[model samples]
Target: MKVLDLQCAHQHVFEGWFGSEDDFHQQLERGLVSCPLCGDLRVEKKLSAPRLNLRAAREESSATRPEGVTLSNHPAQAELVELQGRMLKAMREIMTSTEDVGERFAEQARAMHHGEIERRNIRGQTSAAVALELLEEGVEVMPLPMLPAVKDTLQ
Candidate 1:
């Protein structure tokens, strides 16, 4: 298996593993690779340092080892799970605190921007075109994946 470092258009860096360089290139060409953070498909390969395995030749120097450190074989998995947990918690907080404006997201946002309505936190569904238009108009908005329980339709 080959491990390679990759960065998306949004500059979110992550590692991908493949059977070979050809496999990686094939996946990239097929648009199968994407950024986990923002789901961006425009990914680029990054230069990575080579790893050498000499475990059988010599034991790790005790002097250089960190004190009371225990390493996990699946460190990446643990970190990923923790990060996901934190992200979910933040998303939950936002969903709970924001008003569900349903399908009138674009209208409400525009009203707030034009000072026709009071500015407040809101969550709702909007088309990609609408979101782009809002951004182009200098209205700050973020596209967040809402949890099923936070569906604006029920609001």
Candidate 2:
């Protein structure tokens, strides 16, 4: 397996694994290689140093890590991760407070707006057309992104 450092036209750096240099070229020619972050298809190889994994015979105190915590060397990435955590936390709070009305979100929202049902916080799945229609009818609704993994974990 050949692991090469790849960069997209957007300047997003990532790794690409290939069977050989020829295989990498073949994939690139076919537009199969892309930036994972931005989904850009214009990717090129970047200069990379060979990786050497050496097992230490002894432990080094300087290389020790604290329990239950992992540290990132990139400051920007660390900040982004922290921001993402905060956003997810806020989203989770919103999800907990809102009732899941599923596909009836549009109907429920319209009913509430027309005083046919008591107004309450709700979250659900609805087509873009339905959401637009709800908005047109002056029924307020906020779109909530549902993460499949989080859905199973939510109480």
Q: Model 1: residues >4 Å from true position, as ranges?
A: 1-73, 149-155
Model 1: per-residue lDDT, tens digit, 48-140?
546556663224632455543323213554465457547756777897799999999999999999999999998789999999999999888
C-alpha lDDT score of every prediction, in listed order: 0.74, 0.70
Q: Lowest-lDDT window of 10 residues in candidate 2?
A: 65-74
Task: Point out where model 2 deviates above 4 Å.
Answer: 1-71, 152-155
Q: Please provide, for model 2 over 22-119, each residue's C-alpha lDDT reduced to its tens digit, 9 standing for 90 to 100.
A: 99999999988876555688999977546545445113322685433233224554455455546656776777898988888888888889999999
**Candidate with the greatest TM-score versus the true structure:** 2
Residue 121, candidate 2: C-alpha displacement in angstroms: 0.6
Compute each candidate's TM-score over C-alphas.
0.50, 0.52
lDDT of 1: 0.74
lDDT of 2: 0.70
Instruction: Give model 2's TM-score versus the native structure.
Output: 0.52
Model 1 TM-score relative to the real fold: 0.50
